[model samples]
Target chain A: MFNEKIVNPNELRHWEGRIELYWIYTSGEAGDRFFKALKDEEKFIAAKCKKCGKVYFPPRMYCEFDFSETEYVEVSGEGSVRAFTVARLDKDEKPLEKPEIYAIIDMDGTDGCMVHLLGEVEPEDVYIGMKVKPVLKERGEREGKITDILYFKPS
Target chain B: MSVGKKDISCPPEAPGTPLKDSDIKEKKVTYVEDHPDMRYAWTAGQAISRFLNELKEGKLIATKCNKCRRILFPPRIFCELCYKPIDDWVYVQDTGTVQTFSISYIDPDARPLKEPIIVAVIAVDGASKNMAFMHVLGEVEPEDVYIGMRVKAVWKPEEEREGSVTDIKYWKPMEK
Candidate 1:
C-alpha cells in the first residue's frame, strides 16, 4: 500500500527558468540557389522535377512525392493571392501600431505558393486572386534571405 | 506495377557554380539567425517541496527506504529500485564529498564569463554511497578541487532565504 499525506493547496512549490539561445540556419542546396539568385540578379528560381514535370516554388532539392532530384529553373516572381489575413498583434500578443497584411501567393509558372507580407494596398481593398509582384530591396542592400524581397505589392 | 525504382535524371544547367563553404564566407549565399525569448515554471513535487522548505531553514533533508535501507538525497517519495514507498524523512549533514567537478569558463548561454566558475557533483555524507547532486564550488582554487574532497554547504543569511536550491550560495572546502 502507498502511504499518502494531505498537503495544503497553498504549500505548492514551483521553480522558474528561462531558455536563452541563438539559432543559426544554413541554406541547403536548393535554398542556396534561390537565395543567391535573389541577392545577385533579383531573380526567382524554382525546382522542376525532371520526371513528373512538377514545379516547386521555394524550391527543394528533391520532389516530395516522387523522391526525384530536381533542377533549378527561373520564373517571374509574380503571383495571385490565394488567401490572406490581417495580423494586428505582435509575437507577444500585444497589439501593433499598424496592422500587417499577409497572404499566400500562388507563384506563376509553378505549382507552389509562398506566404509573405502584402504591402502598398489597404487591408479593406485586398481581395482574393489579386495579382502581386515582389518588391525587392535595393541591389546593394540585398542579402541572401527571404527578406531580400521586402513585400508583395499589387501589380 | 510495384513502386520500387525508376530511372530519373535531373535537367542540366550551365556548368560551374557548385555551392561550397567558400560561397557562404564570400557572401554568395545568405542566411538568417534568430533568438527566441521564452521562460518556464517547473513544479517541485511532494518530495522536493519539503526538501526546499528544509533548505530555507538552513537544513538538509533526505528520504529513507526501509526495504533497501538507503537514504536518498534530493529526496523522492518512492524508491525507484525497490518499487516501494519511502518510509521516513531524515536529516543529513550539510557536509559532502566532491565526486566530480569541472572548471567552466563559459556561462549557461555559451558566453565567456569574466571569472571561471567551478561546478561539482557532491555526494552528501548521510545519503547512500554515490548519491550526489550538482552545485557550484567556491572558497578554493580550481586546481585544488579533486574527487573525494570534503566540502560543506555555504548557506545564505536566514533572513534572505527564498526556499530555493540557491539558498545555499555555494559549497566550500571543509577543513578536516
Candidate 2:
C-alpha cells in the first residue's frame, strides 16, 4: 500500500513560521503606589506588615510570613551593597563593549533588598557595605518604571 | 515572644489601591513592555510533501484508502478510520462546492478591514463526501456567496509560485 519514499533529505520540505508577539505587564497594587511615589515625588516606599512589623521593599499587598495585610511607609531610598557582580557578556552571549556592575542593595529601613545596576564608580571600587543612593531620571522624563531610577551610586 | 506586640485588627478597606485602564494610558501607574524573537520550521512530511509539490504544479492531490474507498484531501499517509497506510495518490478537481462561509470585517489582529473578505469551507469535487478545507473566496460579493456555490481555484502564475498554500491565489465562483 505504501509506495513513495524520499531518500534524499533535500527532497523533504519545510515551512518557516514566527511568533510576532508583544506583551504589557502592569505593576500590581503595592507596585502602583511605590513606582508612582518614586516617579512623582522622588520618594521610596516600603510595605510593613500590620501584625509582625516585617518591612518589604518593592512593596507587596500582604505579609509573606503570616499572610496579614500590609500598609505603605516611606523610606529614604538609600542602602548598602550586600553583594556585587560584574557582567562582561550581554544576554545574547556576546561580549559587551563595557562591563556592567550590579549589586544587591539592602534597603536601610526594610528587611528586604533590591538588585540593580551600579553607576558613577568603577567595578574594582565597589564593595559590600558601601553606602549607595538611587539616581533618578530628569523630572519631566520619568515613566514610573523601575528604570525611572536610573541606577544607584555611592552617596 | 510577644514583648513588642501591639493590638492588631482587620480594617474594612484593604491596603492596595486599584487603578483603572485610564491610569495606564495617562501614565499614572507603571508598566513594562517586552517583545521576543521566536521562530519555527515545520517539516512537511511524506504525504504533505507530495501534496504541496502537486499544488506548486497547479494541481490538487489527495490520498485514497482502499479499505474505505475514501479519497482524503490535505492528504495523509495513513487512513484515520482503517488505521492502515493509504493505497494511492489521486488528483482532485480544482473545482469545489462551498459548504459554509463567513464575511469577515476584521483582520487576524482584530483590526477593521476596509473591504470585507469572504472565507469558506469548500468540499472539493472529486474527494469523498463532506471532505472540506478552509480557503478565502474572491471575485464575488459577500451577499452573493452562499452554501452549495460552485467555485474553482485561481492559481498564481507558475513563475511566482513558491510551493505554499498561497500558491493558489484564492477560490473564485466557477463559471457555468
**Which is the leading candidate under DockQ?**
2
lDDT of model 2 at position B131: 87
Question: In model 2 chain B, which range of ten residues has the least summed lDDT?
Answer: B6-15
TM-score of 2: 0.53
lDDT of 1 by residue, A31-110 (tens): 88899899999999999987788999989878877767789999999999999999999989999898999999999999
> How does each model score on TM-score?
0.55, 0.53
Model 2 regions more than 4 Å off: A1-12, B1-20, B43-176
Q: Give the TM-score (vs. native) of candidate 1.
A: 0.55
A1-155, model 2: which lDDT tens digit per residue?
46566565456787678999988788887888998899889999999999899999989888877778899999999999999999999999899898999899999999999999999998999999999999999999987888888899999
**Each candidate: RMSD to true structure?**
10.0, 9.8
In candidate 2, the residue pairs with backbone N, CA or C atoms under 3 Å apart (3 or more residues apart, or in different chains) clash, namely none
* Maximum-TM-score candidate: 1
